[model samples]
Target: MKKILLSFFLLTFFQNVVAQTNLYENPNFDELAKTHKIIAIVPFKTQVQLRPKQMKDMSAEQLNRVEKSEGESIQTAMYSWFLKRKKRGDLQNLEIQDPRTTTAMLKKQTIDYNNIMDFTPQELAKILEVDAVISGEFETNKPMSEGASVALGVLFGFFGSTNSATINMSVHNATDGILLWNYNKKVSGSIGSNTEDLINVLMRKSSRRLAYTKNSKDKD
Candidate 1:
């Protein structure tokens, strides 16, 4: 009985550690976030690392298209997550800029996925007319939105074990481009196989630490 109890405790501890996010919050995040009424979520910079056989079958253009699509899909999923939270009154007094408007403004500034990294967060905030911006990068071994493979993984609970993804997200204050918060996480298995599921998992863990959420300022 003692051995079984010890084993269960260890399993619970391991799960807690694996589920936690690597989060960084600026010392002045509360002060900075107080002025942040509106924010924009941008397309994540995405890189898809293909196996040799897959690489050989795809052209350079096709690879770029896949990366771009994945980036936009993540951005959209993030927006949906925030929208749902806002509707639930968890994100009080905060407004998220529509992604369509954000994209149009970026295009008006001649910024595309390839060149967006050239601009600083403050520059993007000015262009988008938001108080802050949410941006990130995603690296993955496979296309996350591949419905068939992901669905199969959901059903069988093993196919996603072969896939891996790393996400690093940050919030920057528009005034000075100082990073207010950052979250870095690595995800695998069935939960990381699709954009919606991935963002849902990530944001659920991150929302407690996010500056804009209700009562979040008091959390570590």
Candidate 2:
């Protein structure tokens, strides 16, 4: 009996490991990241408003209240993941916040975001003093169905959009904002019927496609 139980446990554990695999929509980061050094990941932010749609069963005021919480919740999760990844420190000289936050400084120097494009990556590399920079974006159905109040996103659709998320990401050289590489993925439809499940799928797929390795994926 002991031997049989042990075998079952081992089989279950191995099956669990194999079940955890990434389903990346685009899987080419290995080639691009090989050349670059420092990478920064911006937490996902989107312009999509979860208002007007979720108003089907609630007053405008009610929907607004729900959406306010939704954006903050998703962003918080993204930032937490970013910090955790940073701690792992796989890449070199990574910086999360942009040195240049405000456009006012550029105006003071009479520099245009457009005009700056001509500068080469080597030059920008010299200016920012970093090997490379990463840019990322996210859009999600937002949280809802917390046992009581639905997350912010569902309230956006007429009766709550099947709670989904879409993510688009790219890596660039700080030097002149060159698009060294990019990746995009969307998790919605019947495959993931709601927000919570959508989050699970995105993380799983990204981990695999991001390829910290073939089987294991680093948060960073």
Candidate 3:
């Protein structure tokens, strides 16, 4: 019984791991990243699909609110993950703009989150005064809350949870409005998971392939 249960657990974990796929990557990612000094992480676009029963019970307005809030949470998570990695010297020459500052500047410019995708990457990069911009979109099967996310790995022993997400991340050059790189992946998260945990896992895999990181040259 013990062996059977352990095998099931390992299978689930590995299944999730294998689901992450790279959809796109730029040929000149390294050169482009080196040329751009600072990068700003924009708020992610989040979409949640509630279960049939939950959808029947929850109002659309409530779902919209959760979606909008989760966007900001994910943006902060991305920045924080990169910042911490940089601080620990795990990332070299990769400077991430503070998410607080990025949001504040966007607010001051009267840019609404819902309408953010309408804006060109060049315009956003110029407004943020960053040499490069990082943007992403996330789709999840449930309304993800920071607390619930953190609780998964923390309380549930790093196994068995209900969250599944697909994330698409991109980088654009400020000066020329060219997309330098992009990465997309599908992930299944655990019960005690949060935005930080999600982004941390994604970034750990994706960043290794990104340009400007210490190990970029060594990867090829």
Best candidate, TM-score: 1
Model 1 is weakest, by summed lDDT over 10 consecutive residues, at 151-160
Q: Considering lDDT, where higher is better, how would the candidates rank from best to worst?
A: 1, 3, 2
lDDT by residue (98-154, candidate 2, tens digit) is 433312333454533334335443444444445554334455444443411444434
The CA lDDT at 128 in model 1 is 97
The true-structure Cα RMSD of candidate 1 reads 5.9
TM-score of 3: 0.80
Better of 1 and 2 by TM-score: 1
Per-residue lDDT of candidate 1, residues 154-190 (tens digit) = 4334533445678899999998999999999976654
**How much is the lDDT of residue 114 in candidate 1?**
82
Give the Å error, residue 1, model 2: 21
**Stretches of model 3 off by over 4 angstroms after superposition:** 1-18, 147-160, 189-192, 214-220
After aligning candidate 2 to the native by TM-score, how far in Å is the CA of 189 from where it should be?
7.5
- For model 3, state the Cα shift of residue 193 in Å: 1.1
> Whole-model Cα lDDT per candidate?
0.79, 0.44, 0.73
User: Lowest summed lDDT over 10 consecutive residues: which window, candidate 3?
Assistant: 151-160
After superposing candidate 1 on the true structure, give the runs of residues whose Cα lies further than 4 Å from its correct spot. Answer: 1-20, 146-162, 214-220
Ranking by TM-score: 1, 3, 2
